[model samples]
Target: MNKTTLRRRTFLQGIASTALTAASYARVRGANDRLVMALVGSGRRGREVMSAFLKTERIELRAICDVYDVQRGRAKEAFKLAPTEIVALEETLQRKDIDAVLIATPDHLHLAHTLATLKAGKHVYLEKPSSHKFEEGSKLIAAVKQSGKVCQTGTQQRSGAHYRRAKEEYFDKGKLGQVIFARAVWHDFPWQRRKIAPQPKPAGLDWERFLGDAPKVAYDWIRYDSWRYFPDYGGGLLADILTHWADVAQWMMNETRPLNAVATGGIYHLNDGRVNYDTVNAILQYQNWNLTFESSVLPIRNERPGVLFQGTEGTLEITRADYVFTPYKGEPTVVKAEGNLEVAHATSFLDAIKNGTKPSADIETGIAACNPVHLAKAAYWHKKRMRFDETATKMLSD
Candidate 1:
């Protein structure tokens, strides 16, 4: 057997051994109760995923794991689950009963957490900014293939109805015939980038555990909840917000990868000592599409941030909650509302699990859309136009 296949098989064996032996409690009479899940990394985001799963009725959360003792309780309280609490992320992976894990920890922990989970034979719902670096993302992609696990990337916009319709009208329907230029923008006022003062350490919080795999640093109040402002723990605004915007572009462009990227902006306006940018505008090039994504910490935005996919006929505007299609021929916007993206996202994932079909927003999509975020950040972070360096493309040559 090949190395990739062998790795995946070994991962499955490890996970299958951990199946929930506590008690096989059946679900409510007539729902799709095929797979039970265990949640890993119970952060604020992890709890949210758990809450959604609680409503799903399909995924019985068997365990909730986190390095922080404080986090595990919140998840238990949220799901009212008798989860086998795990101190380390790996222990969570060892559970054979957990068919899947939702990883919502800090970015730096993603690589290790995902690698361990996949190798242990579990499907994964990995949160955005999929990996800490381009190389890490590549590695996770290989692990996914080797494990033969279904991965749902947490780019929830993929399930947005407005986005689907916009893509259908613009790209699929070709209503926006031969469109080329697209600009994605996000404007956030200072109140949005606001910070709180440093605080006394809280008990039950495993500071060292949270710092797993990240560069060593003294506790800073800003780094705990606002970890995205730092590079080692998060990719900053580039991977955080830009990935969502790029997903829209990727959807509208029919899964296009940028040929090159140029980024310009700086950490101006926001007074806090944030290492990431406050305003970033980037230009990304595809074979036939030219796209620009703009972000701001001080723009007076009436709506939350999203992307605008411009086409020859119209532009598709999308937010986390909804989307809009505007015909450029002096026409009004065709607004579309996606009732609950979280619901849709979960339902899609559950459906994939049952049918053994690839999810709409799988890891491949995550890798493709997020690679540009890294490339663009590399461009501006170093203040230079960057080119894609193809050293190792993974087993699938993706």
Candidate 2:
């Protein structure tokens, strides 16, 4: 680590003890008054998270912040908030009256948004993967300590009943024998296929504002909306989707950090013109066992949909729905499964905000999930079977 990070880390170590006490002591806002929130980035996922936040009875969304004015207007109409339009993210964060901010910005901007929000003393509901860089996540973790903000990650599966049940019933201490391996997969048509091209920036859209922290580039609608396929903006499927699997893997394994990470996958499927592959896979090895997460852009369904936890006593399958408990009692015992977790995920964040507690998917948990994600993606990109760097270990897809 660098001196600045080391110094900040040391300072954060001291603040962690007393910061929550300060948050607890702060004067409570009015019961009738809704917490003022700002939504940064009006992308598809951003809108989804906003919809969840807007569902709450006590939240009065004050402003919608986005670089693209079209998205801002669309979001404003969706949430019915007369958004205080912001192109520059820092300006949006500077509003002292805002109680919290939701960052649905791209991978590269996550760290900036998290740091800025914490510095502004507003709690954050940051989207998945925490950040693009592993070390940057450490910075955000440190910042959270210094700020004492109730930061929540976008890994909403933790709030789902089925996932929670799966963790408790199967992965809990000696519950369903020992969890030997977990396989998570997300497969679907490549996100780049049907996205529209970026039209000319409308009069209200602040192109520069939307490009915050990202490299300067010309406008392309496909690039803006389908940036997940491009290295410059998104982490493709790994950061875009697989982080949810990573979060569950950590939850199931009861682990915060993976001792090693190796990923290997190739672009064998989709012929979309994007640099990112259509298929990607990675394995995160913890102290006791290993978990594998993969995605294929050509087909959305997995060999076994959702996440599969193979244990000694039984095989527990946890997907987007209800989990399946198939006991290996000499003969197979079949249990059907189904799940709808959208509402459950939404409820947890608002509850945490009101109760002054951490949400189910907190920042530390989000960062750890992304560590393997970033490591594995790097490995896949470099085409190495096994590559260990200071940040995270990587293995090529077989």
Scored by TM-score, the top model is: 1
TM, every model: 0.84, 0.82
Model 2 lowest lDDT segment of ten? 389-398
Clashes of 1: 12
Task: Report, for every candidate in turn, its global Cα lDDT versus the true structure.
Answer: 0.76, 0.74
Evaluate model 1: give its TM-score. Answer: 0.84
**Candidate 2 per-residue C-alpha lDDT over 209-298 given as tens digits, one digit per residue, 9 for 90 to 100:** 656678898866656667777887778788877788877877888786665566676668555557777777787777777888877777
Clashes, model 2: 13
Predicted candidate 1 versus true structure: per-residue lDDT over 181-242, tens digit per residue: 87777776554477678787777667787888788888776787677777878876778778
Candidate 2's error at 199, in angstroms?
4.5
The list of candidate 2 runs beyond 4 A from truth reads 1-31, 189-191, 195-202, 269-272, 300-304, 330-342, 385-398
